[model samples]
Target chain A: MTTSTLTHLQTLEAEAIHIMREVVAEFRNPVMLYSVGKDSSVMLHLARKAFHPGPLPFSLLHVDTGFKFREMYEFRDWITKEVGAKLIVYRNEEAIKQGAHPLKLGVARCCGALKTKALLDALEAGGFDAAMGGARRDEERSRAKERIFSFRDEFGQWDPKSQRPELWDLYNCRMHEGESIRVFPISNWTEMDIWQYIRQENIPIVPLYYAKERMMVKRGAMLIPADDAGNLKPGEVPEPVMCRYRTLGCSPCTGAVYSSANSIEEIVAESAIATRSERETRIIDHGSNSMEDKKKEGYF
Target chain B: MNTLDKELFSAVETALLRFTTAGSVDDGKSTLIGRLLVDTKGVFEDQLDAAMGVEDKKGAKGAHLALLTDGLQAEREQGITIDVAYRYFATPKRKFIIADTPGHEQYTRNMVTGASTAHLAIILIDARKGVLTQSRRHAYISRLLGIPHIVVAINKMDLVDYSETVFKQIRQDFTDFYTNLGLIGGELTFIPMSALEGDMVVTRGTQLPWYQGQTLLEKLETAPVTGKINARDFRFPVQYVSRPQTEELHDFRGYMGRIESGSVKVGDHVTVLPSGLTSHIKEIVTFDGSLQRAFAPMSVTLTLTDERDISRGDMITHSNNLPRVEKELSAMLCWMHETPLTPGKKYLIKHASTTIKAMVTSLDERVDINSLEHIAAPIELKMNEIGRVSLKLLKPIACDAYANNRATGGFIVIDDFTNMTVGAGMIQ
Candidate 1:
């Protein structure tokens, strides 16, 4: 019997696997940047498949902002244990002590210290020369031009104007002593591709991605989780509403959409007809060219 | 999920097409892409609103479609595309990935980066300008990169009264120019339309009623997807050796790599190159299960019937069609760095799962982008310059001509000191 051609998903899977193996072969110290999101879940799964019998040769680094939803933390711990790979979770305790919150310090500065700086610190401490992330080009405008093996200077800065010319599937992973490369295996995948792959692979995701009755309070255009009802201001109250997260981040910074589709298949259906982008609900991504600014500042 | 959603997912799974578009800013490349996205409902409401904000600030009528693609802050400030930006859209028939490359002379490296993997190249030409020098340069680069199909989009037809004569003349000019390059066998197509008026892109509008050719989207959707290689030779470069060393799989020694081209089956005799050892394919493995056979672009592991000394940088092929084993080869090199490529200097050549020290023995000639002429015996190739050169590798690599197989034939030149990819090379 003649063998049929591989599907688009299979093609994507093979490309991701090839990239993972290349990093492992080339870099001395490599790690997976796991954020416990749907993209991260798929990435972690691909990592497992990349080296099936052998355990993951690299560790997983999660830069915790100390502001994620409780369910996300639980899922992170569970999956880490399930995959049996070493997980490195780093938090900026100094920033937390200084009260660096999004509301007080603004989203940009807050993310600078808690996220970008923390990630750099983690990589530097681990002495990792290559860090693989799930950042896709379809997520944002600036990302659409990024290379699969995005090079970062000693300061972890991404210079859009002076990026190396990448061609074909032959990625150049060479770097100097202090510099590191950010490898995005799924750089070509779109948002719809991620959801459908999750459905097809039966990847486990956080419960918050599914609709449920939760205590939510309307904050401007976004609906944020009101876990502590006592923090409500005068004439502000928390109400039970059906909500799900299109994308996940810090609970305070991420907004939930009103939805009734509680299953993966339903999420796929909803995502196909989605009129707004997944990042529109992200509170930190506001203002024109803010993502580029943050990315230049070394945010993942 | 409903029946329609299922059908949509199945369609999305069927195939993926990647193409690149090249044109100067005046040629409306970005506008054509924006029109395709908008007409296909790929653009979200918020994205359109953002584009509208930029358009309103510029005092332009309707939405400025070009603003949608010049995504970077610096690009928006300068009103020029600086690099390759990828865009995605899908119809029920197939999905498409667009590599939107800039058309300036200095950014030829970026255009090559976009066209390197594209199956088709869409070279946009302003109808009024006819075939320009920049257009010829882009078409030449697309041909150099071995893109299987070429679509010459004669845009802005409305400005020329939608005349069929103008379209045919441009097409004739391009065909003549392409023929002078001594090229053969690749597909060439031409279409006349106006992206601003939304004619002959995604929808067939009334203005283009005189044309009988397929629209741009139709050509992209129905293009051939596979078996473009010159020979069906199985070439698998060993990437990583997977030895689990577990309790049950203690003896499980599998070689992992992607099948770069051709196909392989179980029980087939294969030879490991550079080592010259032979073995029979015992099993083809994946995370899901074992496969009886696998084809190009599929990543899998193989268990040999006999143990052989094989590691990364080694190649597996059948004896019937073995790739050429070469220690020195000639190639067409595109210098991508500011530092000129000097002869007799050692650089790292990363080709097909292997990195070896290689030195440029000589610079034969540089191609003049403007005239398409060969300037003989260039001492060194500067940035964004293409030349023919000979290289001596420290070790032998099993390779093929770039025209035969891109995956096995193309490589990148990395600087030893800076570790940067400074040049791209295709074996001659």
Candidate 2:
């Protein structure tokens, strides 16, 4: 049979694998940031394919924000055991001790303390030189301009104006001792691409992505899960609704959309005609430059 | 609601085209991209509503389209893009990745970075400006970067009264300038467009009845890609070695890497460079399944029939066709650092999968951007300056000319102290 040219998905997969190998080859100690989301699921699948026969050389790092949905924790543990690689789960113990929740301290302070600050502290403690993320350019406006092998200073700050000129696949991974690099292997894959690849590879994802009848509380324009009824205010009621989350984040900061897309195929089709971006469901990204600011402060 | 149809899923498997846009700061490059995204239905309704609500800072009417591409906070505040922001949009026929580069003269390095991997480049020429120096400069850089296809779009025709005479004159001038650059053929095309009015970009908006040609989107959808790289000699730079070292697979050793160019198959005779050892492809392995053959850009593991002494940085090629193994060579180098590149400076030259210490022997000549003149024997190169330089590597590395196979031809120069990529080179 005559060989055929590769489809876009095939090409993207190849490029992503090539990038993963390059990171392992160049960096001293690398780690994969596993968020247990769909994008992370796809990244983990590619990582396994990138180095077959041989076990994974790098460990998976999960910065647990303590406020995530309970299902996410279960999936993370199950997948970590199946991958058979070392898993490092770091949480902000001080914040948890101080009872710092999104509702109490506000969204900005809560994310900054639990997610961003905790991530930096974990990387420093582990002495990791390279951290890999599953961030895609199509996710947000700021990410659309980031490099594949993004450089960060000793403080883990991202300078948007002074990025290195990345050319072709020749990623420049050299940096000072105090500085580090954040490599994104799936930087080119869009949301639809992630779902399609997940379906194609039969990769397992968290159950929260599909719609089901669940107890939800109405908050302004969003449907928040009624995980804890004690946090409700006056005139608030917990009710069952057919809803699904387009993204997975802190339970208080992530909202679910009303939909009946229970399967991967339906989600793919719904994404095709969806009027709002997936990030619209992210409550913390209200300001136009919120993501950019958080990134500068070392948020993944 | 649109359900998952067979045809819509097939669109996900279509060909992908990667291109870049180039023009002066005032040439509406961003506006053209916005128009493309809007017409292709790539923009979401929320994004449109937000754009329409942006506080018309510059008082440009109707949704400051330029704001769409300037994603950085500083760029928005300063009202000028400073880096290469990538954008994605697709039609049912093809998917596109647009590297939207800044047009300021100071940001030439960003433009070069954007154009390095592009299969095609759209050189925008403002119809009223009529092919200024910036237009010619952009065209020159696109040609230098070896972009296979070029579309010279005469933009803002609405401001020029949709004059056919202006469009023809600009096209003729651009052709003359490009012909003078020693590259000529069917690769160059021209399209008269008004991005603000949305003419001849995604659709033929009935403005230019005299001009019967493919719209910009049509040409982009149909442009050839990947064939340009796959047509060259087979080059595979080994990136890593995979060894299971387990009881079940104690003797398994696989060379892992992507096919930089050309194709490879089982039972094919190949040779490892720098060692001159011969081997036959025993098995082509992938997680999906084993294959009889694989082409360029596919990342696969190949276990050779013979256990040759091979490691990372060593190249594998067909036994008959080979690359030049040399220590001293000349290349067109683009300086990307603020510090001047003095002659006789030693730096790290990363080529293919190997990094070696290299020294610049001499600055042969610097190509003046404005006039395309070669200034002989320049002492040093400044930021964003393009020049020809001779380099001597400590170890001999296999290389192909940049024009032949871009995968193996390009290299980046790294500074020793800062460890940043300071220069980009294309072997001559």
Candidate 3:
């Protein structure tokens, strides 16, 4: 007979489900920052589990950076309907109008103007009192200090030094007006946990993670996807290559590895022995303290 | 399933060991965590190379093992961890989650947060300074939190010339002080180690040949984790009501929540506390499918054959075992903010999903964390101070003792004016 003890995956799932319920019970108007990545997919599944037989209490908000891959859009639309989630999409139109491209404006400026600013503007306009993201502590070093219910100022910036002391499972969700909390349901889960949960639960993710022949242009050890011209540098020509993305982001900034492992089984096996950190592939993460800098600017 | 997937699934079935490292600065907590990661192959080549590059910046000779865990820019700049950094490592036998916490007195709240859910604690004592105040403070807090196991890891043995007498003296001192606290037995463990020299951490290095006990990793892998997590009377605090009212499931009404303790199954008679209504468990619903039985820490939606006024903040329990409901509460409180705790100020007491206005009517006494002595009738509890207090609540709460169950017994005090969490209270 199997023992009553919960597996590691089940433990992570339980913690995440508890967080979802807390947000719905505490906040006035809450929303989910659905990035349509593996983490987001697992979070969406957990949310549904948290409030089964009832609609998800919060709306799913996607801050479109105007630079995601073509597959991300399709996946977003399909998954939202599949789970019957209330979906909201927003973007900073001024940046798109003024031509704030990644290469032209540079990685830091482009991410700040297009991504972080867009998220801030969306949160403000929607008047959301709480927002949940799939940020895990294992992803970044600074995130290791993050509280489960991370408090944000009126400007939506995180203060690492003065975080409220969270003891036991009793998180302090009390906040004044205009000040919101960024709730990370899966703060304890690692990257391997995510893939394992996804595989076990059969949660659907973007096919961009699977290996296939794709049009890419090599740019300094990175396979810049040729799906968008903005991703290519000047003298770069589109070529065919077999690759898959470890982590997804802006089409211009995210990098793809030369991998032939296509199935979920293959990916998990390959990742078990893979040496590179998942964040290493993203161009924005190359700069020292870029993640902390972006987070201070209200980036998710 | 394929061969690789099956192997991974079997590995996932292993229990996760959650432990916290508590020691003052220079006790080499970070070095121990770094060596554990390295020995387990948890650190990648790229990460090692990155740490190697920071060796010079940190002004160390070799690859500073501390640099592997001191991940933040501020931590590296100050050469001390400012917050709890969780590190993960797995040997084929088991997986470990290290809550590497800072030992500064100013950051005691961080350590409390880290120790809240830990199954075991590693209270490191520098062999040079036998049983310092910080070590005793940490061990006392761990005991108060009801952590099942405590390992007093006597570290920095190399600096103490690996003298068995020094290690034994510190261990004996810790024992004498720890036993007088009237704590439960079979919870204390002693081990001698040198984190910087990589002795008795993950491996039994040759330097500590005088000691024959198991290494740190071996102890972790084989330690009988003691109490069961879900063996108790059922307590499920209703978190949300779920009713889709769709055509496929028209008359569906399920109350969703995570079982804080114990287990429940279909046809089990349960009583909804704070209402005194009885209902039978009709169904247990999950996204994947329905579970025949569910236990603690599992999130599930349950439907009852008899419907009553059950919503968020209401608890479901076995009919024979009901919790005490009272308007007056006596608890041990840990102050967490700059604002001092006054006797007559109004504050919001949040227990589970219920928040009630409460006032501290009496300040009984404070515990001197260092000497474990009582300071009677303290004026107020400052930041990081633990004391006994009496509170009068406007509304009654159904609760059990913290020693009986943590979820129902623990509460937080929210400031009336700022709404910030100011204190943590454990129902006595």
Per-prediction DockQ, in order? 0.72, 0.72, 0.63
Clashes of 1: 0
| Local distance difference test values of all predictions, in order | 0.88, 0.87, 0.83
Clashing pairs in 3: none
Q: Give the candidates in order of lDDT, highest first.
A: 1, 2, 3
Tell me how far the alpha carbon of residue A136 in candidate 3 is from the true structure, in angstroms, after superposition: 0.7
- TM-scores of all candidate predictions against the true structure: 0.97, 0.97, 0.95
Instruction: Estimate, for each residue in B1-428, the C-alpha lDDT of model 2 and write its tens digit.
Output: 34346756877678778899998778988899988987887777666655556454446632467666678778778888888888888787787889999877777898899999798999998898888888878888887888889999999998988999999899889888888877633288999999988999998987888889899999998988764574558898999888889898799999999999888989989999877899999998898888998888899989999988899899999998899898998999999999989999999988889988999999999999878899999989999899999999998998898878788889999998888899999998
For model 3, residues B193-286, the per-residue Cα lDDT tens digits are: 8887778988888898889888888888876542425367688888777777888878888887888878888988899878889989999999
Worst 10 residues of 3 chain B by lDDT: B54-63
Candidate 2: tens digits of C-alpha lDDT, residues A162-268: 88889988988899888999999998887877887887788999999999998888888889888875446668899999999999998878889999999988887
CA deviation > 4 Å runs, candidate 2: A1-4, B1-4, B52-63, B184-186
> Candidate 3: global Cα-lDDT?
0.83
Candidate 3 lands at a TM-score of 0.95
